[model samples]
Target chain A: MRVGLDVGGTKTDAVIIDDDVHILARTRLATGWGVDAVGATIARAVDLVCGEAGIAREDIRSVGVGMPGQVAPGSTRVAHAVNLGVRELDVTRTLEPILGIPVRVENDVKAAALGAHALHGSGSGTMAYLNLGTGVAAGIVVEGQVWRGAGGSAGEVGHISIDPAGPPCRCGQRGCIEALAGGGAVAERWGRPGALPVRDVFDAADAGDALAVALRDDLARGVASAIRVLVLTADVDTVVIGGGLSALGDRLTTPVAAELEAGAEASAFIRSLRLRERATLLPAGSPAAALGAALVGRTTEEVLAHG
Target chain B: MRVGLDVGGTKTDAVIIDDDVHILARTRLATGWGVDAVGATIARAVDLVCGEAGIAREDIRSVGVGMPGQVAPGSTRVAHAVNLGVRELDVTRTLEPILGIPVRVENDVKAAALGAHALHGSGSGTMAYLNLGTGVAAGIVVEGQVWRGAGGSAGEVGHISIDPAGPPCRCGQRGCIEALAGGGAVAERWGRPGALPVRDVFDAADAGDALAVALRDDLARGVASAIRVLVLTADVDTVVIGGGLSALGDRLTTPVAAELEAGAEASAFIRSLRLRERATLLPAGSPAAALGAALVGRTTEEVLAHG
Candidate 1:
């Protein structure tokens, strides 16, 4: 069995999968902040998940971790995971000796992208997993491998400015896709004190609130622009929307589709691309990130041998 | 010796190269309009270039032709070559039987991208060849292979709209990168008669013409955005500016560098990218496109065996 863990800001999701990736057991635990605590949380989560599966630690072949931070290509070190309050952490060094198994770490978004590909990929071509979370970002998977570009920033489409006059991005750009569509950006712009501000904004838009309507429209526009950029730049076969905002489901996809439809109606080239048909939403509560981490643990040499 | 032909709208540039891709001989011929003439032109150009190199046709290993049309991935067929008045043409079928040499065709921009990579690639990572001809387009190369995305529309950054309220494009979008920076678009917007209107616009801008200054700024803005998009999305190590507009050399790159510098000044993240350092201009009259086509004709099997 292989083990995978999604180390998020508030929670660590763990899963044990068999050879065919069938989940043997799954569990979740509150994630701790900082390097030491997060490391401890991972250790505890692995123990709990192994217990849940009624398996000995020796039965686990390898462990893979999906972290919400910068995982450099080909390295287990994660850096600047602000949401988790982690300045830096070398996951392999911390976990390998304790677990007595091979370990690998990948960025959460990229891990999810790999999982999404395994779950829903067409078995060929490319798919971009666009994360519309606290800040928008994406991960491109081509032929089952994550496209980690030269500087390990291949899918940073959120910073691409579509509007020079729309809104200022935290990245110091005006009218970035994130400024228009990010969950945190939307919540901040809505300026309402609510745990689910984006959901609230959507609810208010349905009631014909002009401000909410505009905000919702911008969200759709930003998402549609991201889809276009992905298709035009990377020419990914599909863009699977998966993030905190995607939990809204049809409420989110419908408007984003409308925006794509509008662009199609305006341009024959855009129409030919059929962006609306290509954009899709990941199912709510999917364990893609965790599942992908397990796959990551298999190591490059093992994958080559097995496949 | 390998033969490469760059079949453009008005001229066909042909070159003969040795095993190391060094140019041994080069020649040019006026391209004829339509299918038959274009096919004939390719045959004649190859023969002439071979003769110029003092070699027999049998001495040539393969021939590659670059066309200004859509060459579907892994196909030798060229379609919708409006610039050359060709609606459709299977370049290989037309020439292979006549010349008795293996023939391959690729889009001009894509061919140029490969050539640029061979000429200036860092020997690792990725590079984007941004073409600023009558229209703006780019072709990305990773390692040594072209990144032909799923639908083969990868690197069509020209049509991506940066300003919703900017100038209208022939593709029915407003504020497209092409609309702002394309030679054709700038010429139309400038509305003055000249063989080289973009050059005139620069000259006028230098003389403090208000309209020219605005046009120049827009051009820089469009190019800068393209560079940013290439870096942010693909994380290419460098972007080489080529095509007709690059003939302006420092006149064009200077303003483009300034725009990147200004963006870096505004955003610390942008500064971190060091975009100004990454964007570069291809040398004038470089034989990259033809050389790339020659390389392309070597075929997939050949590349695997040789590399």
Candidate 2:
């Protein structure tokens, strides 16, 4: 049996999977501040899942962890994760001694991409998974492996400057896709007198609110522009959109696909080649990061054994 | 000994190197229309170099050719090169058969990056090479390997949208770095009645022409914005500026450095990290693309053999 744990800003989820890849048990818990509290929460979740699965602690071969941060090789020490309020936390040391199993750590978005890939094996080709939630980020899978650039900073689709002089991004750049189209940006643009939540903004747009409609279209354009850049740079066949805002469904996918079609026709080189447009929308499951993390551990072990 | 050949828009260049990597001989010829003419020209250049080095053709271990287009793996088939007005040209089949030597073909910009890596070797850690010439493109090298994203379409940095609503780009996009900051853009902007060549714009800027100064600063801003995006995506230690336009030394580098520094300060996360600021403003020698192409063959062979 293997365990997957996804740690997010609000919650931590754990899933126990048997050898046949069936989900045996699952548990969720609120995440707390500080490394020790987070570690305790994860350990408790793991224990709960293992008990529910009717498995002893030793039966759990390995644990995989996913979080928002830069991870070092073969270690759980996060190099940097600004939103998570943690830096250089020795996750492996904190969790491994308590859990009594080998652990692996990876970037949360990367884990999600892996999960998405596992669900649709066709994504083994050059695939990009974009997350448009509180922030916009991407995890690129190239040839069935994550293409982490130097220092694990690849697939930062959010930071690609779409507007040189537009709104400032959290990354300190001007007019990044994130600054203009992320969930926060959508809320800021549509949250009028009542300060509507991001999800409600989409609902209002569906109800024909002019401001919300415009905001939705603008977000779609941003997503489309990002897709165009990805195509031009990676020449990937599939693009999977996940994260909080993607729940809007057709409100996001239709316009984004139309934009891509328009942009492709604009370039002769792009026009010469036929591109396979994979699913524009996909649900990365609520505990996708944790599942992806567990899969990472499983795959890493497989690769190491075979390699 | 290795040979480097650059097949450019107007001309083809070839350089021969000895075991010690010293340049032995160089040849230049017009790049004719058909593949046969181009192949013959390359063969003649190789013969001339071998004669100059007083070595038999068999002694030349490998040949590298750089073309202005997309290259397939293990072959010199030009997938698409708009500048050369050629598509799907079988360069390796044509040239290797004629020259009776092994040939490797790569994108010109990638070759230039390899050349820059070989010559300067300053940014040996994690480096990027941005070529601001007739067109603006970039080649990213991470840990001494060219990062060919999913397919061979990884380093089309020029196409990243800078302005979604700005001027139309050659790639059919609007407000790409190429549309605003490439050599053609500069020429079009300043090539008014009685206006000098694009090279003279730099001279005029040096002479304190206000219009020229503004143009130079704008170019720097554009390049700086691209650099900022690169930093966020790649987290490289250094960036090397090459191509015909990089001759504008500090006029371009200083402002770009300043802009990036200002951008770094906009976010606490960006500021907290130790961002490397090593920038090289140097032009590769004439025929750098060809030399870089040759180096590609040598490097790839070494990598394959070792792996």
Candidate 3:
């Protein structure tokens, strides 16, 4: 069986899958987000996932882990992950001994794109997976492969300057889409000091809360702009929304679709590109990133290349 | 020998290339911008180029042509070319009878990308050719192949809205980066009627005219944003500036590089991306599109696919 691990800011998910892409077992646990904690958490989750499947850790062919940061090309060393406070962690060396198997690492968003495309892509052409959770970014799939880009930064679109005069992002840029529309931004703007979750904020907006209404509208606009940028620039055949905010589904896409229509009405080129028709939502409970991680590395060379 | 033709708004350039990629013959002439004028113009250029090479049309392996607009896949039928007042013209069908040879068509900017990569790319990875002439757009090259996005709309980044409150573009969109920075927009903003060309706008800016400085600054910002978009999203290894504006060279890139440095100072991710270092200027007067168009088709299937 193959092992896939997705390490995020709030959760660490692990899965075991057979060659046919069937999930044999899975595990989800809170992510301890520090240098030592991250490594331990991933190791525990891997052990727990293997145990659940009643499989020996030695039986696993390889471990593929996806993290939310820059991964050194051809290695599992994570250059940095500001959110998780990870710096220069060599995942391959650290995990290879514990698991007694080979390890491959990739950026979380790129892995998610690969997963989304593997499960949902028809293999017709290129597609993008837009991840909206604590942060917003996109992973691009070209010709059935993840476009890792020159510096391994292909999918990092979270900090694009959406509004030059808007609020500042954690990355020190101002008016980024992530700051205006990501779940973290929404929670922060609600000013509830973690008392109100992102879902609660959305629920309040649905119930006619005045501030929630405006914030929701702005969020929709930011998401809409993100979609436009993806469609207009990359011209991907489909854009699947994944990550945490994906659970919101139509409540988010409805506004986004409306915004697209409004823009298309004004621009013939936009209308011709058919941006709205290409937007899709990931399945409700599937671990897209983990599955993608599990599915990658059909060969050792490919695994290293993907890393 | 291979033949290439670049059909532009103002001029048509043709070149013949030997198997060694050396230029055997070259020709340039004014292009009339109507439907019939476009076809006849391309036909005349082909005839002139062949005559210059002292070869019969039948001796030419294939003729490749690049134009600015949407080219129907597998054919030379132009869907629309507003700048040239041409629509639905089948370049292959019309030019084949005139030139007595096979023909392939591609977007001029995309062709320029191929040409630029062929002439300058290190073959390390993806690269972009940012053409700033009558309009602003990009042509992406990956692994020495043009990446025509899923919808064949790849590298068309001109119409993206940079500022919601900015001026209007010819495409009926408001505040597009093209409107803020493209040659057409620069000429329009310079407001000297036919007296001031785009080059003159830069000249006035260099002479320290107040409006010219502000416009030049805005153009630099728009171009810098274009670079950021290319780097952040596609992560191309290098971006070579081409087209009419490329003649300005450092006069333009100095400001654009400055803007990039300012943005990088604010965002660590941007700094790490090394967007500034990745930016390069295409050498002056290389006839990138013509050369690319000439060397584009080595096989019938490849030619049709490129079309």
Candidate 4:
């Protein structure tokens, strides 16, 4: 059995999977501050899964973790995680010896992409996966391998500048797609005077609120623009949209699909090709990051064997 | 020995290299319309190089050509080239027989990235090569391999939407980066009344014309925005600027570097990372696309050997 864990800003989600890719058990708990507490929370979730499944700890062969931040290969240290307020935390060292199993960690978006890719059965094709949650980002998979650029930062679709003078981005650029259309931006635009969660903004949009509708459309445009960028740049045939915002459903996908079609026709090279869109509206029931992390471990093994 | 050829909108350039990587011979000629004429022009250039270097056609080894459109592997059949006014032209079938050698073709921008990666030695790391010429596009190189997404369309930076409602792009989007910053757009903006080329605008900017200065600044901002996108999305350590517009020199690079520095510190993920700015100026000696094409042939050899 393989154990998968997803550590988000607010919650730690865990799942256990068998060789056939069936979920054996799952658990969730609030994510605590500090690296040690977070590690303990994850451990509790794992233990709960094992207990619920009536299996001993030894039955779990490998543990995979997905978190929001930079992950170095063959190490558990999270190079940096901005939202979680953690940096350089040795997750493998802290969790492995305690859990008595080999552990692996990966960036959450990359894990999500793997999960989405696996779900769609398009593992052989190049896939671009975008998650529009607190922040917008992408994990690009080309022929089953994640295209991490020089510093493991290749799939940063959020930072692609959409406007040279539109709005100031958190990254200090003017008019990045993330700055204009991410969940935080949407909430800030449509939420009440007090800072409301992004969910409420979607609720308002669904309820036919004008401001909310406009905000949603704006967000859709951002999504479409991102898809265009992906299509034109990566020439990936399939695009998977996931994250909290995807719950808006057709409001996001319909417009994004249209935009992608339009962008493809604009480029001579793209015009001859057709692009396909896939929906990842819900987080995979399994801890995708964890599974992907496990896959990473397996890939490392293969590489080592070949070398 | 390797040969690189770049076929631009106005000109065709060829460079022949010795095994020691020294330029053995070079030639340039105007590009002609129709597949046959273009093939003949290329053949003439290859023959000139072989004759000058006292080499047989067989000793020439491999040939690489960069054109302005999509290309298939192991063949020179350009799938689509809007600027070149050709579709599915079997360039390899037409040229290889004439030259009696192996030939490889790639998208001009991808070839430029390959060339920049090899010539400047900056591409040894994660590198993003942006070409600002008749059209703007990017080529991403990671770990010495070009990252071509699903359909070989991975670096169309020009089509990344900047405005959903700003201006109509040829791709049917409103306010794509290409619509705003491509050389055609610059020429259109500066052409007013006389319809001068973009080069005239750059010359005017150098001569301290007010309108030219404004246009130059706008162009700089556009370039800066692309750089921001490159840094944020790719986390590339080096950016190689090429294409005809780069001929503007410091009038472009100085402002772009400043803007990138200002923007990098704004992101938590980017803040801790050091972004290095390499030479904005490429070697004026060789056309980047042609050099890149030669490297593409070399890459094809590597891929064939490994396969």
* Top-scoring candidate (TM-score): 1
lDDT tens digits, residue span B1-307, model 3: 8889898888899998876667789999899878899888888888899899897888888888888878755656776887789877788888888777888888888888888887887557588999988789998888767877777777777887767777788777787889888988888888887643666878888898998888888899889878887877787889888988888888898999999999989988788888888888988878788988886656545533432
- Clash pairs, model 4 backbone: A162-B162, A233-B153, A233-B154, A233-B155, A234-B154, A266-B171
TM-score (all chains, Cα) for each model: 0.97, 0.87, 0.92, 0.87
TM-score of chain B of each: 0.96, 0.83, 0.91, 0.85
In model 1, which regions exceed 4 Å deviation? A297-307, B297-307
Worst 10 residues of 2 chain A by lDDT: A270-279
Ranking by DockQ: 1, 3, 4, 2
lDDT of 4 by residue, A57-98 (tens): 999988888888878644567867876778767777888889
RMSD of each predicted structure: 1.6, 3.7, 3.4, 3.8
Clashing pairs in 1: none
Clashing pairs in 3: none
lDDT of 4 at A184: 77
* Candidate 2 structure, TM-score to reference: 0.87
Report DockQ per prediction, comma-separated.
0.83, 0.42, 0.66, 0.48
After superposition on all CA atoms, how large is the RMSD of candidate 3? 3.4
What do the candidate models score in CA lDDT, each in turn?
0.90, 0.70, 0.81, 0.69
Write candidate 1's Cα lDDT for A230-263 as tens digits: 9899889999999889899999999998899999
Candidate 4 lDDT over B106-138, as tens digits, reads 888888887777666453367778888877888
Leading candidate by DockQ: 1
